[model samples]
Target: MSRKKTTRHKAIIDQLSVNPSMRVSELSDALGVTTETIRRDLEELAAQQLINRTYGGALLRQPAEPVLSERHKANVEERAMIGKAAAPLLKGARILMMGSGATTVQVAKRIAFEMNNITVVTHSFGVATALSLNPTIEVVLAPGVYHAGEGAVHGAQTLRFLSDYSVDWAILGASGISPAGPTDALMDAAEVYACMLRQSSRHMIVADHSKFDRMATARFSQWQDIDVLVTDIAPQGPLGQALASGGVDIQLAG
Candidate 1:
């Protein structure tokens, strides 16, 4: 378009890089433009997912893992099938540890409706809320700092509380799973899942095929730490070899 408009777009991105957020008035004043122009700019940037529009301003978007709420809506059928396939493994579980994840939330739904008379210790509020629907299942929430973005808890207190107890199984989900192992997008989340696996007799990872071979921020569990992988598809290539050689059972939900 015009040179002025080109310059304005660059200015908007640059200003956001400096302060990460600004009001329409502030940007308009700085750019020597009308408030309406700034609003239009913001609308354009927001449409590109470059920033999040606020009531009166905007927040610069930082690249990171997808929001938990949005992730719940993705891979719905695959996660549901993985959840259903994981049920037989929990057949006789007494006390268990579950980590926070969209796929784990699906597993929690099954336990809440089908299973009975089991106690679960977890850091995810979503899992707790789901399991709470069943009066017979006791839900123990781990003490920690609540993370609104993840709808879970993670901190020193959570690790300390979990370390004190042993459980029949530790069930978790992963953002990525490669030859190295299962991983999470957040360091705190990775640490929490690792700790849960260590304290349980059997460790199970519930993830869809989308996670296969993808590497995330942190690898939390080695194959030795994982007993079963409940997924929607069979592991292929190096992922398949690693799991087999490492003695980790892969159960395909399909």
Candidate 2:
């Protein structure tokens, strides 16, 4: 690719990383290129399995996690407030399990800073590493194939390891949530979360406002399965009403 084309490719991927879906015209306008050029770039990206071409746009591949460096850029304050709110709930718990994602990492940071003598079991390398900074916290990593982009482990081995230990609390994250409940963009991550839910005595999902009403590739659990939800904003609309009626406790950080 020429220098200019390379620059456009980088910009396109960066935009998709943040929004997940975008149209050719949007890319064209954003990149200062013709629609035809943007379409060609989208086709190239799709062929490389970096994105999925749609009718008028492209979306991030279903199984792919956003580059970790970019994940933290989307929702900063909301995630932090959520972490602070969630930390107190696990205050007395001895054994805690954390799932992978930016919000969950924030929770781990709060747990490490505010709590003491906690044992954290997780497949998320980010969670484990963050908690390890506190000597009072013991971090146990579940074994599995590593997904570097996600900074987590997931596979049959990880599931088996998680099944062996029941934690006092499970702090989880999600790619999307609907009235049907929390779903994940990737099946492997969803499967691991299902195990995490089962192997823990209590569990909750920590996500930001953006997750509401979005649908991912797989639904991991029903609304009634998890005990609580921590988010920046209270969900709205009919789906929100349905989730509210479903009996899971909803806690808003903001």
Candidate 3:
């Protein structure tokens, strides 16, 4: 796919993720493209199984979220910046339970490269492997049914395994962060992440600004439970108001 097509495809998926379903004309107007162009884009995205083509629009694929690997490729710079900004929050944290997501993987990589002598409790294969580069940091992989697409396991067994230990922090990434708070497209993550928040003393959510004002299939956290939010750009509009009202410390990565 061309770079333009890739960017547009990401936008389509992002839009569908926030709205659940979007009409062709709506997307065309929003994206500043012709209706026919929007139709063509929807058809291509559907063929890749990234979205479900409707009669005149599209819907987010049901049950599961988009492929993790594909997602990590979308907001590369933003994820990296958010990851860097979140690393310091882990400075005094001895043990942290982290969820599996694209941005969380970036956070793990940053932590491995910058921090040490810490223990990371997680079900994400990517997080564990990223932490392996720093021998001083212990990597504890939670046991569960493995998923090839996510390269992680955030399911019933993973939740059970993590419930046994109380950690210094629960650091996670979200599919969407709206006025209501953090949400996830994957049910496995939606449930397991809430458990993580309960099992830890502090909670931090890492997401790019693209997720601002977006809502997803399931909510993983309440506004009162969140300690901090790290993102590339400062959230504005209703998202900004909500974060402020919730007393969440917003950190912008430069």
Candidate 4:
């Protein structure tokens, strides 16, 4: 490939990383390239399995996760607030289900410190270890294929294991949520979360304000699917009202 072609391809990948989906014409204009050039670049990227070609443009083939160390540092205050907000609701639940995310890890820590005699089921190694230190909590790790960078296990085997047992409540973390629904960057992650939601009687979403209105590559569930949403602050505007009208309880932490 020529220098220009390589540059165009890199630009397309960057755009798709941020937006997930885009039209070829939009990408062409954004990159200051001709439509035919954009099309050729898209074809090459698709061939390499870096992207999936749609009718007009392409979607990123795999959603990327930040390194676990880096992810642990982002949004510290917001995650703590979310964890604090979620802790009270965890009381008296013998079997607690938690999802994998930085915020959810904080929730695990909070649960370990505040609650006792709880059996925690999770795909997050971080959550399992965090709670293990408490000794009061019994951690049940679901078996599956581990994704190293994300530090979470996912796949059909994991889902099947989750289906065998039901939990009193499930606390979930999401990449983004809007009026439309909760979404994840990766489809596999979404699938695992969907299984957790299905197996649990009560569902709660733990997210920060930054997640509001952001879109992701795949959707796991709508706002209605959750019984409660715990965040640092209440969402403002139409999306917040939509969630309220839909009978989803909102919990905001100080």
Q: Which candidate is the best by lDDT?
A: 1
lDDT of 2 by residue, 28-125 (tens): 88889899999999999878777766567776654544766688888888999999999988768999888999999999999998999878999998
- In model 2, state the lDDT of residue 23: 68
Candidate 1 regions off by >4 Å?
Answer: 1-63
Q: Give stretches of model 3 more than 4 Å off.
A: 1-64
Clashing pairs in 1: none
Global lDDT of each candidate: 0.86, 0.84, 0.84, 0.83
Q: What TM-score would each prediction reach against the true structure?
A: 0.75, 0.75, 0.75, 0.75
Off by over 4 Å in 4: 1-65
The residue-level lDDT of candidate 2 at 97 comes to 85
Candidate 1, residues 161-228: lDDT per residue as tens digits?
Answer: 99998999999998877666887889999999989988999999999977765657778989877899
What would you estimate as the lDDT of candidate 2?
0.84
Question: lDDT: which is higher, 1 or 4?
Answer: 1
Error of 1 at 209 (Å): 0.7
